[model samples]
Target: MDDVRLSLREWLILKDIESALRRGRRIGGLLRTPRRSIWLPTAVGLLVAASGFLMVAGIRTSDPAVIWAFAAVWPFALLQAFRLLCRWTTPHGISVKASR
Candidate 1:
């Protein structure tokens, strides 16, 4: 019957996808997309890097002003990085509601 044939085809497609995953092949590579997706990660990377650098500099430097300024900025950079990461990873269609 046609139903059996369609089920078999779907099973074969799933099996192929499983094989590809086992082979360490990405689905993204299999289906080429035209979308650009680099900037957010780059920004996050820069923010984390800057936060680390500021932390180290604040620790090592003897000047109080320099230490205080870096201390203020570092946490903000880290928080921004975390926010960007969360935003980038969250699914577009799902809306999160706060529990009362």
Candidate 2:
């Protein structure tokens, strides 16, 4: 390349672009975090709540089928709840390995 030089205005613009690219990686990582998406957690919470309702109905009416249904669903619901809890409770800095 022939001698290349950036005028003051072009240099400032390039500096801004570099800064933006530096920040983009952090933004990308945050977008990947589970907390940003509400649907999955909402669904899990609904499942756990529905399981509680089923157990209550089973006890109140002495229904074996309702109790069995609750049993069948409870494990998966609770596990999802636990995993979601762990993920949400973790500090974003630690989870994303962010410096700032």
Candidate 3:
């Protein structure tokens, strides 16, 4: 995370927020507005579904391509499964910490 750099717009936004708060204006509520994420959910959904299909196909056949696909996909699928399980058992709106 420390290696990551903010883009120009993000840096400007942070600066603006800091300046606003310094002037004693109530500007924090502007952050609660949801920004549009047009493709993120759809992309993740597709990736997970493809991973599941690969895992199942690899287990059912001996094709080299299927084996390669499974190798690439299984770890992501397993991690996603664990995340989903945690979300299901944990209380709503509480974020779970993943171990390093």
Candidate 4:
């Protein structure tokens, strides 16, 4: 790296590119962060399944309260699913511990 000389303008541009990459990585990490937790995903999965059951019951009986209950649970389930999807879409990589 020392063998290569960059002009002041080029150095600034390189620094900008590096910062942009760092910011992008941080955002990606935040988006995929739910996978790092155990209970969150488990709860989301349970909620999704329960919501499905609720919807079926509401449909079979044509009950207003049960339909409303389904409406309430469905949004949360969808949000959690979206969060979970982020982790699934993230590419796996070789992770290493940082040196002390």
Candidate 5:
């Protein structure tokens, strides 16, 4: 096991492969998104809008309602975070541009 260290070139090649896989996954996701998939965001928007209305109407137990609203918004937040992290760690000038 002590003699199994990867050389610099080997490490670079492995890194390149990993970056390529990430880019491929992103592209696949983009290509696979159907027009009907627009409904997901629209639904989420409706939930957010309803939440806002509930809050504005001074409904009782709005705290729980607001918490549910945050939960609904969380997936988008996490997706953005993952995208940011992937953009940060991946090599530049190959697949995606560096985040400013």
Candidate 6:
């Protein structure tokens, strides 16, 4: 029974270490990818642009309250565009580039 308990503890510790190592490797890989970081910003920009266009085209709704809501959300599109532009201009080796 004692031996069994010892082995179980050892197994658990090994599993923990393995999981930690895998997480570390994943983080390292993320750091290595130059385009990973910019995906969110690009998506946000597209969403904003789409929403703004919808508002302008009167496709969203004619209600003044709804138009105001769309207008309020318009800045996110500009923010996303700025983020994408920055990511594109940043050097490849930098952390910012890795995320984009």
> Cα RMSD (Å) per model?
10.8, 9.1, 13.3, 11.4, 13.3, 11.7
TM-score of each: 0.45, 0.57, 0.40, 0.54, 0.33, 0.47
Sorted on TM-score, best first, the list reads: 2, 4, 6, 1, 3, 5
- Rank all candidate structures by their lDDT, best first, as comma-separated numbers: 2, 4, 6, 1, 3, 5
Q: Indicate whether candidate 4 or candidate 5 has the larger lDDT.
A: 4
Clashes of each: 0, 0, 0, 0, 0, 6
Query: For model 5, which pairs clash?
Result: none
lDDT of 6 by residue, 41-78 (tens): 75986777778776876654577776776777777777
Off by over 4 Å in 6: 1-38, 57-62, 96-100
Best by TM-score: 2
Q: How accurate is candidate 3 locally (lDDT)?
A: 0.67
Off by over 4 Å in 1: 1-37, 92-100
List lDDT for all candidates, in order: 0.68, 0.81, 0.67, 0.79, 0.59, 0.69
Compose the digit string of candidate 5's lDDT tens values, residues 6-83: 999999999887667657955544333233335445555665565566555445565876667666665665565565
lDDT of 3 by residue, 59-81 (tens): 88878899898788767766766
In the predicted model 6, the residue pairs found to clash are: 35-100, 36-99, 36-100, 37-99, 37-100, 38-100
Off by over 4 Å in 4: 1-35, 91-100
Q: Which ten residues in a row have the lowest lDDT in candidate 6?
A: 29-38
Expressed as tens digits, the lDDT of each residue in 1-100 for candidate 2 is: 6989999999999988766765796565554444457876998989989999998999999889998999999998988898788877877754535485
- Candidate 4 lDDT, tens digit per residue, 2-26? 7999999999999887667657954
TM-score of 2: 0.57
What is the Cα-based TM-score of model 1? 0.45
